[model samples]
Target: MATSNLDLADIQATVLRYRPEPYYGTHVLLRIDDARGGREFLRRLVPHVASAADWWLRDDAWIAVTLSYAGLVALGTPEQSLRSFPASFREGMAARAEHLVDVGLNGPQNWEPPFGSSQVHVALSIFSGDQLKWRQAVETAWAQFRDLRGVTLLMSQDFGAQPGDRNSLGYKDTIGQPAIEGSGVEPLPGQGRPIKAGEFVLGYPGETGVVLTMPQPDLLGRNGTYVGLRKYQSRVGAFNRFLRENANTAEERELLAAKLMGRWRSGAPLTLAPERDDPAIGADPRRNNDFDYANDAHGYQVPFGAHMRRMNPRDTRLAQLTDVNLHRIIRRSTTYGAPYDPDALSERDDEIPRGLYFIALSAKLMDTFEFLQREWINKGDFMTLGRERDPTVGLQENDAVFTIPKHPVRRRIHGIETFNVLRGGEYLFMPSLSALRWLANLGG
Candidate 1:
């Protein structure tokens, strides 16, 4: 019997497409006032949902729909059916409330209403190359729901970022993602090994060769996956100030930044070009993700605590003990706010409302996404680095320190502050394309 049971046509587009180009996107959060009315709304919206097959064509506008724990219940899903979902999704992001604060999420007191509060029901995402086209697609799809009695569009966030690769912080993002076994995107030279398709999609064997448990009905869980969505607010002015205070020259500053992120601003890996930035190497698809930390175990070239290394410790000693492959996640991030002016770095004091709309997909929410945030990114003891945290995205205070291992002794940088703050987020169930139809036709 085949170990994999995935029908690519049944999966959602976002689960596999690493980079859907010409990207202009929006996320609309909705609240369902009445269970019956909400189910009716889904009935009308099913035709617009894009599938994995749709993404392969890479031409027309695309849309995906996911639901919060409250969403499934609000849509009249039976209690038994609701119980079938994973605990992480069912209890929702609030279950990790205390952990969220430790990971630098804005405290519970400051969390936006309906985000961690279980008030949001539906999450609709629409993306396209043309801004106007994306907007029209959203409007056309939600036309009926606009006046529906029980459905309310609580918030609609517009994300417009050019080039579709770099984040608001001026660094190339999404350079270290694992290539799923069946994603069609080939693994690069230094990307290590191709992760199992089951690690991401349901009904397939993950690293353990045991198929992850699916919810009751096969159709509802077969091609489905869990998603963790968070909106990050970047502190660009503060980051620039830190570099200025730490490094004297522009070249030195770039190198320091590379130490913090494990990749140059141009996407070059520090392990490959430890001395300086190499734009050509970073730009080459084959070379950018072709290096690992085995040779630089002491983190001389790539700091052990660097954001990339901490997130994905590819084929290192840690991998020997723990299966890092099981913890892999597919990231789909987009910058929301305008880029900060590099020239005005000195005059800026106030914070800017710009950062990434972060999204990560995996089969098990707690085992992968939550584990990474709580155990790896927020803590550094696993790498034997002590209390130090990831300078790029870790939770930090004035006393935070980052050490660079030199031959004779180590150099330490102190007074580090967190540059990324979580504004809002939620755990959602990204059901299969067929499951979506089943949800729409629930009662009828």
Candidate 2:
């Protein structure tokens, strides 16, 4: 089940669904099942995929398949699962690969499972309303897969979001997206930032164990990129209130949200038309990633402190931007738990604590995840002055007291408070489709 190139139409034809990638969104993961005789089991399953598109469907749509030390006990026959596979198995399918664990490496036979090892976690992106049906299909499929040992499912949908939505926040999600200028994925324009060959696929000679390198080169073509999955919570109510109280004018409030977010809610990027909404420009594929911040001298038009500006500054020199943003993740976050009910908007006490199940693919986590959290999002004044805290999901250094400047140019401090908290997250290196198959049948 390997193909050189999988067009969107063909992918849609097979999955019977399609979702054009977005800058910010949700990814839903369903824990399906696990098998113990890992490599052997996967070896037998790979050929059964039937087509290359099926492999891509699994690779792009499925999240990481994390195995644990406790997996041996869960295999039901610890002794059998503990037995070592031939060296050829290591050579042919597992040399220099990270996390290619032996049965008893972490602990002797008597030990329990490691922190997250007892089960194999399988995840899928929540594309649309059809996800419920898709989840059911995935559950049935895994249960029926012969190699999987015992299957149990847990729905993980609660997660957080990046700052700035259309309504009140001064932002839009994924401000500067790279248009494939010459067929390859060049993260964005202004700086010939072409997504390198090794960036997305694996099994290439130099790419083994490299987190940013692509995993499945033989199966996926040159442009195919790997996605990462994460979940985060957003304090929409608190964020909305902050803008209402802080902003001097409705226009300023709207501008701030758009600036911080990188786009107007109408999906327009502040880089192109910073002042007002431009529906046509935002929607135009040819023009969206065409602008740069060099034109804005004072950081007023598109604030230097703006999340989009700081994250993707569009410069080879002087920008001091990290190489991470080049591995641009297409965030597919969606609100989970309970829908934002119009009636609940006015409630004195929220009946349910809600958030997002964040998901996206990146060549490396540091480039995408850590940088966004530690540098761009967490740093109170990212690229400019008076822009401390994202007001929605951004972390405040201290809960005791806080303030944000009125304008990116003014630096006038305004009182603020802590908003959201990051409850939990894990850095999972989602393996290529072949890697998953190799993992499933380890000993068998």
Candidate 3:
């Protein structure tokens, strides 16, 4: 996960391999008041932090640590080191509300406690499929901070797969993942040659053949990366009602679902199985992300505004407009709350709370995640669809329209609404393992 040295031992495993599939996890935010205590906390937590060495097959559960800009300042980071961070991250997510479309209902002022606020300084995330392992990881983190009065626990949330292992929206999750050059995993059919390590990890050459400028000191930024975590509470009942009112038949409802998502609930992409879903293909990783938009030039199968296509234009002409590769981001999102009843897909049940914790890891926050949020997700002109936004995550109006390009003529479905609402969001920097030790030894 590092440079040519491949210093996996000095880098957090989450930078490359996030959680394994079908995983359960807990995320906790903290605020620090005492610099010495904060450094000591890092001192004790380093041993529990997992590195990228042979990360793919690791059986043990692990915890990843990230710090907001204020966290670094609270830890007594030197002025030079603090000045090296980009303004976007330094300002924090809440300050950029307008740029991220966090305005309206998703504004920072309406966010949950500890989020969208400078009070948040630390984020500890645990990932594991086994209940015991997950519990142990949480307990490990608890042991470190529970007694440290200087460190206050702002909030904690648990996330995993919904019933039948689908996302909150009743669709398969973790469908698309980036293929990084040094990550040991072989690229899937659709995932081209692994992206340059620098595109993801710091201190390496990206696809552009240039090293991404990092934090001032070599130690702090060598393997560090940026992470943007947004808490979304899905309006499941409203979404189900939206589908029921729009489509006439069950089959038509399913088709409409596939069209909206660019993939069927089974995870089969519309490009390969546009007419009907092939669960076999959906379940198969080799074929799931293999197809491109070249054959579907007019977007007959996958619409231009489809979330997947908009996120990763691939080799299509639209890719040129945005240089999709430059803005490619690694997602490791997790669903929170109890699993919903899939049998009653249309039944309204807004009383209970459940949604996704959208996590994105990238080398540069502004050039990647923020870029997509402002240009691609919120605005429609990037791909020539005026006023169209991402149907799933886009901040929509009462009369938003989702155009589905089809045979004979294009079908325009009006009255689209924002399915995912932002309850909380934070931008943090996940430093390298060596940086962790550096922070621990601070003020020495």
lDDT of each: 0.78, 0.40, 0.84
Ranking by lDDT: 3, 1, 2
- TM-score for each predicted model, relative to the true structure: 0.93, 0.62, 0.96
Residue-wise C-alpha lDDT for candidate 1, range 1-444, written one tens digit per residue? 112235767888888565555477888899999987898888788777877764445436678899998999998877778898887678778667565443334654456666777788999888776667787888876795997889998888877554525677778777677777766655668777888888888888887888898875888888888888887777877788888889999899889988999999889999889998999988777888888777997889988878888888886566226778878888888778777544436424326667888888888865677677767877777788778877877878658898888788988988677787777788898999888888878778
Provide the global lDDT of candidate 2 against the true structure.
0.40
* Candidate 2 to native Cα RMSD, angstroms: 9.3
List model 2 lDDT by residue over 51-145, tens digit each.
Answer: 22332232133222332223322433234332331222112111211221212221123222221332323333323223444454344335443
Give the higher-TM-score candidate: 2 or 3.
3
What is the TM-score (0 to 1) of candidate 2? 0.62
Where does model 2 exceed 4 Å of error?
A: 1-34, 37-120, 126-149, 156-175, 178-192, 203-228, 248-250, 316-330, 337-353, 366-368, 380-392, 398-409, 416-420
Q: Which residue segments of model 3 deviate by more than 4 Å?
A: 1-5, 342-348
Scored against the true structure, residue 335 in model 2 reaches a CA lDDT of: 43
